[model samples]
Target: MILDFGDGFFLRQATVADHAALAMICLKTGDAGKDATGREDDPDLLGLVYTIPYQVLEPDLAFIVDGPAGACGYLLGAADTNSFNARLVSQWYPDLEARVADPGPDSSRWRGSDWLRHKIHHPDFAVPQALAAYPSHGHIDLLPQARGKGIGRQAMAFLEQRLAASGSTGLCLEVMPQNVHALNFYRTAGFKVLQDVGLPNRCIYVAKQLGFAPGVAG
Candidate 1:
């Protein structure tokens, strides 16, 4: 086991070379932070939806932690939510059509497959309320082994710093309302919480304004 201490793991910009490992991490971390290997026969679906887009479209914003074993965690996101969604519909989804399957009553399939089927046609976008304040949004996942020891915090800080540097007004991420651990982590990282507005799928959007010179009205 690679210890969390120095020299055991390191964070780096993600590249095509890390694609397979990143996909596996997406699958393993798919089930609300638990392994989704048993939940989906199509092991690649989760990664196809969540992990691969940023790799292809916005590589500079995506990062990964290399553990002694393999990829321990990653954070990836879009700098502009609206533009990213438009690109996903116009450029990305067409190529993925061949890989999709009809989401039927298959308890064996990953829930992400159903989402993939729907979003291919429906083209969902980020919450208007969220985008109004924070145009950039990110998604992160860390393997159980990667938790604690501040790796997640480092990864988050990396994104926050990068976004602030890029002149973003704010940044946001969708957290499950039930995932108290993730909520706490994000809160500690300086993100502000908004009351759950009863959205579908129970996603809670949290955000933080970038470069808020302290004590100034935001």
Candidate 2:
């Protein structure tokens, strides 16, 4: 599944073996301004989890970017609300619970934990409307070298095709509103702003119908 992007970059479906490297990318690129899961707070550990049995529990929607020995980027997803997000919560909750066991008022982990709890209890958790067809989209990241080469777009297009096969209407994800480039990228990709679901900061939720080709010019 390695896609030669020319100029030494490659795209491939990640495997259980690639978890550590992929996690490093996630850790290095996490939205430090806001890590809702508290998972991204530590990149190395996150990488370890990705390569382990955690993914064996859910495999259809995870991938990585490889360049050299280290992983440059990754894209992980879930198809249905019950399968993807649920497995994510099930896998991470205990660690979160442990971290918050005695988190004082000064603890960001405490706040993050509370936020996680709130979202899980929220109606969206009950039935994330976004999951209806496009219910399973998520973050995609690349190393600095990989930007603007259409790797992100290719990864997205790959995901959209997967969604379409599943009968999904579209794919959805959030981006920092201030990141003008990303906003424009999605718009060009035919994704419209669904809403602003930013919590700590203003990250807008955007979505695109699944069937359109990524050939659209923004």
Candidate 3:
């Protein structure tokens, strides 16, 4: 176990066996930090797209959040966003594209998991120039059972330390503008808003400098 949060909650390194649990957590908390089960037809798509790749390609930074009830959340990171995205495009997306059909560009006809299917076909790996300074990127999600107990804060700190230890100078996360709670949480944790006009309408990037000094261990 990586951390023991008490009350039967803890953090651990994620394994291939934990993929299903990670996907479930992603689906449950997929809708702007709320349950999105009702909106998804194929429950695994969200996890397949967002969570599993981290475990497969960047295993060192992938972690699971566990509670008394079993796996309830995850914390995933890529130490270098550009390289990670490149790997995804070259190594990951092709197999995924074959497994799922594109829902086409007609947004009006897309429903449930169709939007995710479309994303699979036309994957966007663009890194805005504004985010270039913060090359590391991360994702975190928790089920209701794991929320409101300081797990998120601790999990983030753990990720930050791991990144800094690996010589990363900064970390950034893309959040939905509507997720006010997440925005507030990140702000409280020392992240600052990065205004990037090139980002998609649904995205707001918040970043923190890792403050690692040369020749010093994080």
Q: Write the per-residue lDDT of candidate 3 for residues 1-218, one digit (tens) a residue.
A: 98998899999999999999989999999999998999999999999999999999999999999999999989999999999999999989999999999889999999999999999999888888877668899999999889899999999999999998888888999899999999999999999988767766778899998965455322
Per-model TM-score versus the true fold: 0.85, 0.70, 0.95
Top-lDDT structure, candidate number: 3
Pairs that clash in candidate 2: 19-51, 23-47, 130-135, 131-135
Model 1 shows how many backbone clashes?
0
The weakest ten consecutive residues by lDDT in model 3 span 209-218
TM-score of 1: 0.85
Between the candidate structures 1 and 2, which one is better when assessed by lDDT? 1
Per-residue lDDT of model 1, residues 112-153, tens digit only: 457556555455664565346677889889887778878888
Q: lDDT of candidate 2? A: 0.59
* Candidate 2 per-residue C-alpha lDDT over 1-218 given as tens digits, one digit per residue, 9 for 90 to 100: 55666666776777767766665565555543233234433345434433332355556667777665546767666566466556656675455445433334343555433433433233133444433445556667777767788888887777777778977656777687766777788888778876423322445777776654454322
- The segments of candidate 2 whose C-alpha lies over 4 angstroms from its true place after superposition are 32-41, 45-56, 68-70, 99-102, 105-133, 196-202, 211-218
On a 0 to 100 scale, what is the lDDT of residue 104 in model 1?
A: 54
